[model samples]
Target: MTARRADRAGRALAQGLALALALAVVSPACAAEADPANDYPTEARADYVFACMAANGQTREALHKCACSQDVLATILPYDKYVEAETVLSMRQGVGLTANVFRNAARFDDVVADLRRAQAEAEIRCF
Candidate 1:
């Protein structure tokens, strides 16, 4: 059951990424909006969608909600800052000195707070 669930998650992730990439490519406005602050790459958006959907569940409705959530996140956060915050979060999961840097930093906390707020807003608006 666990293996089947993992496989399903993987397939859903791939489909979400493909859909996000296709949307980014086909939409000129998305490319045009790739400026200094709001420049979320198609890959980044897709990654966000994949992760969100995985957390929410692998249903079709979850995919749509995750996509909407990412759209809200992209509107709220710049690509560079979002990357920085996400990197801090990812690194904080480890048990080494590097992880300590992420885990003990107020800046990291602030960024995460911002992300959480954005996510909350997204949930309200999308879900």
Candidate 2:
């Protein structure tokens, strides 16, 4: 490799190291914000919904808002147990809401009931 290229790489590394050190020293005040896990009520809720929706493979466009709404619902109900109780697969992207999965309404209702019950439990627990 060219000496100039090596020297430039070394300088970049050094600059990165210096920036890291500076951040460590100057970021305490920023880090002083309450920890979500222990200090904030909504943080854990948001985290839970985000994780659950991600696991269920909700659409990216809906994830943030869906997670937030789920978090609020979870406060009224426990989402964790609900998500745990059923098999949640990814919702098909671009599929209309009226798209039918099963031919039988009874069977589809059963599946929906299972999912809703899970959500209901989560809401109650979150509350």
Q: Return the top candidate by TM-score.
A: 1
Against the unseen true structure, what C-alpha lDDT does each candidate score? 0.85, 0.54
Which portions of model 1 miss their true places by more than 4 Å?
A: 1-38
Encode model 1's per-residue lDDT on 22-60: one tens digit a residue: 887878665556644347777888888888888999999
Which of the numbered candidates is closest to the native, going by highest lDDT?
1
Report the C-alpha lDDT of model 2 over 7-37, residue by residue, as the tens digit. Answer: 9999999999999999998775454354222
In candidate 2, how many Å is residue 80 off?
16
Q: What is the alpha-carbon lDDT of model 1 when measured against the actual structure?
A: 0.85
Worst 10 residues of 2 by lDDT: 85-94
For model 2, how big is the CA root-mean-square deviation?
12.4
